[model samples]
Target: MTLKPLADRVVVKMVESEETTKSGIVLPGSAKEKPQMAEVIAVGPGTVVDGKEVKMEVKVGDKVIISKYAGTEVKFDGQEYTILKQSDILAIVE
Candidate 1:
């Protein structure tokens, strides 16, 4: 199954990030704050809202940083994904 976003929404999957200490001990990703980094899975086409055009800045395969508390989480095909609006995406990671 695939998630296709609509109306300026975006679907993304969280990218696991790990931290390493100076001693070479790697800490698990679960121990950190809410994961804000994710990979763009699907993108919605630009839409018109309230007489304004809302364009999507992120595209599929793009790495982005989203708001910690934004979006809805969905589990599909045993994988987790977040569906959020384009405005919730803070920045795109180059």
Candidate 2:
């Protein structure tokens, strides 16, 4: 099965967070913070809302930073994904 987002929405998979700090200390899972970065898996076509056209800036395979608490989490076929509006995406990582 595949995930296809609707207008103005995007689907992404979270990038794994680092398990060790700069000092080479291995942190436990309980001490790790959720990663803000993700890789774009799918993008929705532009949408029209309130008489304005909202174009999607991100595309598949683009790495980006998402809002701290944005998007809904989904589990499919043993993999996890997040579906959110384009607006919820903060910046693209080059």
Best by lDDT: 1
- What TM-scores do the predictions have? 0.89, 0.86
How many residue pairs collide in each prediction?
0, 0
On the 0 to 100 scale, the lDDT of residue 72 in model 1 is 95
What TM-score does model 1 achieve against the real structure?
0.89
Residue pair clashes in candidate 1: none
RMSD of each: 1.7, 1.9
Q: Indicate the TM-score of model 2.
A: 0.86
Off by over 4 Å in 2: 19-30
Clashing pairs in 2: none
Please give, for residues 19-55, the per-residue lDDT of candidate 2 as tens digits.
Answer: 7679999886557788888999999997999999998
User: How many clashing residue pairs are found in candidate 2?
Assistant: 0
lDDT per residue (tens digit) for residues 1-94 in model 1: 6888889999999999998999999989988888889999999887898999998888899999999979999999999899999999999999
All models: lDDT? 0.92, 0.92
